[model samples]
Target chain A: QQPVQSPQAVILREGEDAVINCSSSKALYSVHWYRQKHGEAPIFLMILLKGGEQKGHDKISASFNEKKQQSSLYLTASQLSYSGTYFCGPKRGGADGLTFGKGTHLIIQP
Target chain B: EADIYQTPRYLVIGTGKKITLECSQTMGHDKMYWYQQDPGMELHLIHYSYGVNSTEKGDLSSESTVSRIRTEHFPLTLESARPSHTSQYLCASSGSTSGKETQYFGPGTRLLVL
Candidate 1:
């Protein structure tokens, strides 16, 4: 089943912080974060595994709670370049294909 | 950027036409996938391959077929394209290491069935 994303859309001023949440009905072993700009393919952002691991890069970070079957992506000090639709794909294992959420639209204004 | 590539970045074709979308990756990844997405929508996995000669249909039912004859090449073909097939097709390959599974995507092909 496809995961569900919260706050379908969000608008933020530059340097502001934003959070996008993803939840699945079933337990997930891994959650992947990607950002897709207009007219471009989705770019890999971060991956969070089970065991409540947290991962991030630059100012973007994510936390995974396997028990809750949910993950949250944190974008700190958002920039205009960060404007894009963020997707969260959940997988049970490495070989299992991902089930992506509808995605959260994030627009960072200058 | 990923070494993966997809041909025909954009295509406008008449219905019932047979078309093939080519995807190739030089990263030597064992897993390759095809996803369909509408404008500003969720990605739906249509096909995937574990390796050469190992193809699988994803959760989303698709009318297209895929062939994995070579490790670095996976192509998707539609026998009779329809207007419903008009969408963005994304090709991705994933590499795993120490529990980190990262997928690299191609620029994608935007197909418009007329």
Candidate 2:
């Protein structure tokens, strides 16, 4: 099943911060975060595992709560380039593909 | 950067015509997936493959079919395209790195049926 993302859309001033949340109804083995710019492919931001281990990305960070089947993505000092639609994918360990949330559209303006 | 690629970044075809969307990855990852998404909508998984010759339908019931005959290629086909089938098709692949896997996506193909 697909995860649910909060704050369907948000507008932020440059240098501001924002948080995007992803909640799943089913237990999750891992939660993945991705960002897709308009007319571009979705890029992998990071993956948070069941044991609370986080992997990937340089500027952005995320936290995974396996117990609650939720994950939150943190973007600090957001830049204009950070504007895009963010998606959270809750995954179960298997050959099946990750289930992506509806997505959060973030817009950063000067 | 991810080496995955999708051809015909945009396609406009007539109804009832068959079309194949090409997806290829140079990373040689064992896991590949195909997703369809309408503008401003969530990405829906149409198909996925763990390895060569292993193909499975995803949660979304799609009229499309996919084949994974080669490790580097996974293509999706629609036997008879319709207006309802118009959407952006994205291809992605994931590889394990120290027990964690990161998926890399292609540019995506935007298809329009007239």
Candidate 3:
């Protein structure tokens, strides 16, 4: 099943911070994040495995809480370049095929 | 950036036309997938492949079919296109390391079935 994402859309100013959340009804073994700009393909951000670990990429980072079956993407000091839709792909178990969420629309204005 | 590439970045065809969406990856990843999505919407997995000669349908019911005849290539075909088939088709390949799998996606093909 597809995970649920919160704050379907958010607007932030440059240098501001924002958080997007993804939660699944089933337990998730791994969570992957991607960002897609208008008219472009989704780009890999980071992946967090069960261990309840936090992974970071540049100013963006994510935390995976296997216990809660949820993952949160944190964007700090957001830049205009960060304006795009963020999707969380959580896999319960088995293969690498991920069930993606509806996505969080983030807009960063200068 | 991902080495995956897709052809016919944008297509506009009439109904009952046959079209093939080509996907190729130079990374030599054995796992590939196809996802369908509408504008500003969620992604739906339509098909996937483990390796050559191994293809499987995904959660979403798709009228399209896919073939994995080579490690680096997986193509999706739609024998007859309709307005409902108009959407963005994304191709992805995943590589595993240390028990973690990350998918690399192509730019995607925007299909407009008129």
Candidate 4:
């Protein structure tokens, strides 16, 4: 099943913070986060496994809740380069293709 | 940079014409997928292949067919193009089933059928 993401859009200023949430109706084996710039392919950012593992990249971090089947992405001190669409892809049990969220458009200005 | 490539990044064709979107990856990954997306929209999986000679339809029912004859190439073909088929086709590959193994995506093929 496709995951639901909250706050379809957000605007932030340089050095601001933002969070994007993804919740799945079914049990998710993993949650993957990706960012896509205008006219560009989605780039993988981080992945949270079923075991409630957390991963971080630069000022970006994510936490996975196995019980709630939810994942949250945190962007600290956002930069102008952070302006893009963010998608959450959840991997269900034995599922080959990742089910993607509707995505959240993020705009960061200086 | 990702080694995946999609040819003819932009295509505009008439209805009833047959078209093929080519996707090739030099990464030698066993898993490949094809997804369709409109501008500023969410991605929808259309097809995927676990390996050569193994292909499966994704959650979305598509009029297109895909072939995985070689490990490095996974191509999607539409028997007859229509305006509804117009969208961006993205190709991606992954090394394993592990969640940590990030999937690399190609720039994508943008098609416009009129």
Best by TM-score: 1
lDDT of 2 by residue, B1-114 (tens): 899999989999999999999999999799999999999888999999999999999989999999999999999999999999999999999988886888899999999999
Worst 10 residues of 4 chain A by lDDT: A90-99
Candidate 2, after superposition: displacement of residue B111 in Å? 0.4
RMSD for each model, in Å, please? 0.8, 1.3, 0.9, 1.1
* B-chain TM-score, candidate 4: 0.96
Clashing pairs in 4: none
Per-residue CA lDDT of candidate 2, range A8-98, in tens?
Answer: 9999999998999999999898888989988888888878888766543556789998988889998888889999999999888755798
Candidate 3: global Cα-lDDT? Answer: 0.93
Better of 1 and 3 by lDDT: 1
TM-scores for chain B, listed for all candidates: 0.97, 0.98, 0.98, 0.96
The top-ranked prediction according to lDDT is: 1
Worst ten in a row by lDDT for model 2 chain B: B94-103
Q: Higher-DockQ candidate among 1 and 3? A: 1
Give the per-residue lDDT of model 1 (tens digit) for A42-101.
Answer: 999988888999988999999999999999999999999999999999997668678899
TM-scores, all candidates, are 0.98, 0.96, 0.97, 0.97
Question: What local lDDT score does residue A85 receive in model 3, on the 0 to 100 scale?
Answer: 95
Runs of candidate 4 with Cα error greater than 4 angstroms are B97-99
**DockQ (0 to 1) for model 1:** 0.86
Two-chain DockQ for each candidate model: 0.86, 0.82, 0.77, 0.78
